[model samples]
Target: MTFSIVGRCEETGQLGIAISSSSIAVGARCPWVRAGVGVVATQNVTLPALGPQILDLMERAKLGASAALDRALCASEWSEYRQVTVVDAQGRTAFLSGKQALGTYHAVAGKQCVAAGNMLAGTHVIEAMIPAFENAPGHLADRLLAAVHAAIGAGGEAGPVHSAALKIAGEQSWPLVDLRVDWSDDDPIAKLDGLWQAYRPQMQDYVARALNPTAAPRYGVPGDE
Candidate 1:
C-alpha cells in the first residue's frame, strides 16, 4: 500500500527517501537514513524495527547495505511477509519483496536510486519513479518530490493515498528535511511539495541555527533571541 524511492545525491553525498502510503504516518515508520551510513525502507507488512536495525548495522556494525539486509533477513522468521530496500553510503543498492507481500509489488534499482512499491497500480508505478529521480534537476529534495509525484502520475497505489513523507539527511545527525502529510483529503504528493517549497528557504537557517546561531538569520515571525 506504499511507493517510495531511496536515493543519494552524487554531488553532496546526501541521503534521502520519499514515500507515500494508504496508511497513516508512514513518516514514523517506513523510511530511515543516517548520515555517512545508508538508507532503508521497510514496507509491505511493514517491519518498522528493521529500518533502524539495518541502519545500526550499517553504522555501528560497519556492514554494507546488502550484507546488512542479507544478515538481518537470514535471522528473521517474518521475512516472507515484509518488503525491504536499502542503499548504502556508497550508492550500492538491494531490494527484497517477501513472498506474502500483498498485491502487485515491484522494485527497481538504478544509478543512485531504488524505487519500490506494493499494492500498486502495477510494476510501472515503480518503474516511472526511477528516471524521475535520476533525471530530476536541482537539489536532492526536489528530485525526491519529483519521484513520488511521478509515482502518483503513473496511477499510484491500488487505493487512495492518505499520507506521504519526504526525508533527506545531510551531514547532520538529524534530518535536513523531513516533510509529511500524515493524512490528506486530496493529493498528499502536492501537499508534500508545498511543504517543501515553504521549508526549502529556511533549511539553511535551521542548520545554521544549530551549528552557529550567532550567524543565523531570523525570519522574524516569532521571538528571535
Candidate 2:
C-alpha cells in the first residue's frame, strides 16, 4: 500500500524522506522526518509515535539508527506487523519490515539511506530503489525522489498511487521543504519530481534570504531596489 525512502543528504547535511502510496493522504500517514535528528517511515499498521521516539533517542545521542530501531521494535507489542526505515543525523541507515508485513513487503539499508515498502508486486521494487538512491546524483531530496521513481517503475504499490510527499529538515524541527501530492490522476512520481524542481529555486532563495536578508534585496532590479 505504501513505498518510502528515508535518507540523509550528503551535500546539504540535511535529512530527507519521500513517500507515495495507493492509500489516500499517504504523506500524512507514512513519512516522518526530523531535520538533524533522523528520518522514519512507519507503515503496515502505522505507529506514528515510533517516529518521534526513535528521533528523540537519536537526538540525545543515545543510539544510532540500527540500535534505535531495535529498541523501538523490542518495546512494541505489534512490532511484527510494522515496517520502518530510519536514517540518523550522521547518515547511518537501518530498516525493518516485520515478517507479518503484507505481501511483497521488504526493506533495504544503504550507506546513508534506507528504502522500504509493502503491498507491492514483489521485493524487487524496494531492491531497485536502494541502488537508485545510492547511484543517484544531486541533493538528498533529488536522490530520495529518484528512489521513489524507481519503486514506481518496479511496479509500485500493488495498485495506483494517490499521494506523494518529500520532507527535509536541518538545525530546526520545522521542515525546510515539505511538498505533497495528496491525490493525483497522472504519474505521481513525475508530478512529485516536477514539484521538487519547481520548489528548489524558491527554497534556495528563501534560505539565502534567511541567511543574509540584507544581501537578498540587492539581487532585485535596480528600480525595484
Candidate 3:
C-alpha cells in the first residue's frame, strides 16, 4: 500500500519526491531524484530500477516526462502491477496506474506536481494532496511534505504505513535533502518533518563545503580545527 507526490519547484527548478507506505523501508525502493533532471516515484509492486531508467531518458536521452515514462515502461515485463509518477525539469508531469496496481488506485497530475496512491482509504487521499502542495508556502521540500501530510490526513493506506521518505535534489549530483523513517509505526511523516527542520539550516553549508573547501565554513570537529 503506497501513495506519493513527485514535483518540481517552478521558482527554483528543483525536483523531488515525497512518499509513504504500509510496507517497510518504502524509501529504499520508491522515491528517486536527479538534481537537474527530474523526479520519479515507482510504487505498488515497484520496480526500483524504473526510477533511474526513466531519469536516464530524461537526462541523457533528452526526453520529456511523458515520453520518458513511455520508453521506460515499454521495456518492463511487469508494468501492469506498477504505479508510477514523473515530473520533469521543465515542470511537465505524467503518471500511470497499472490495471493490476492493486486496491483503490488513483492518480492526478497538476501544475508542477503528480500524485498517485494505491490500496488507499479513498480517492480523496490524492485529491487532498495536490491543493495542499499548490497552496502551501515555503520550499519544495516543505510543500512536498505538506502534500504527504495532507494525504495521510485525508486517510492513508488501507492499513498503517510504517515508513516514509523525502528527497530533494538541487545543483549537486546528490540530494540537498534526503530523510527517511525506515520503520516506525508511530508516525514517519512527523519524524521526517523534524529531520528536515534540523537539516534545513545546514543544507547550503554542506553544499558549499563540497563545492569550495576554502570558502566553506569550519566544521568545528577535531580534524576540521
Per residue, candidate 3 scores C-alpha lDDT tens digits across 92-193 of: 999999999889989999889999999999999999999989999999999999999999899988899899999999988999988999999799889989
Give the local distance difference test score of model 3.
0.93
Better of 1 and 3 by lDDT: 3
Q: Which candidate tops lDDT?
A: 3
Per-residue CA lDDT of candidate 2, range 130-221, in tens? 88998999888888888988887888888888888898886665788889988887877688889889988777666667878876645466
Q: What TM-score, over all chains together, does every model reach?
A: 0.97, 0.89, 0.97
Q: How does candidate 3 fare on TM-score?
A: 0.97
List, residue by residue over 59-167, the lDDT tens digit for candidate 1.
8889888899988888777998999999999998988999998899999999888899999999999999999999999999999889998999999999999999999
Worst 10-residue lDDT window for candidate 3 reads 216-225
Deviation of model 3 at 97, angstroms = 0.1
**Cα deviation of 211, candidate 2, in Å:** 5.1
Residue-pair clashes, model 2: 1
Q: Give candidate 2's TM-score.
A: 0.89
Worst 10 residues of 2 by lDDT: 215-224
Sort the predicted structures by lDDT, highest score first: 3, 1, 2
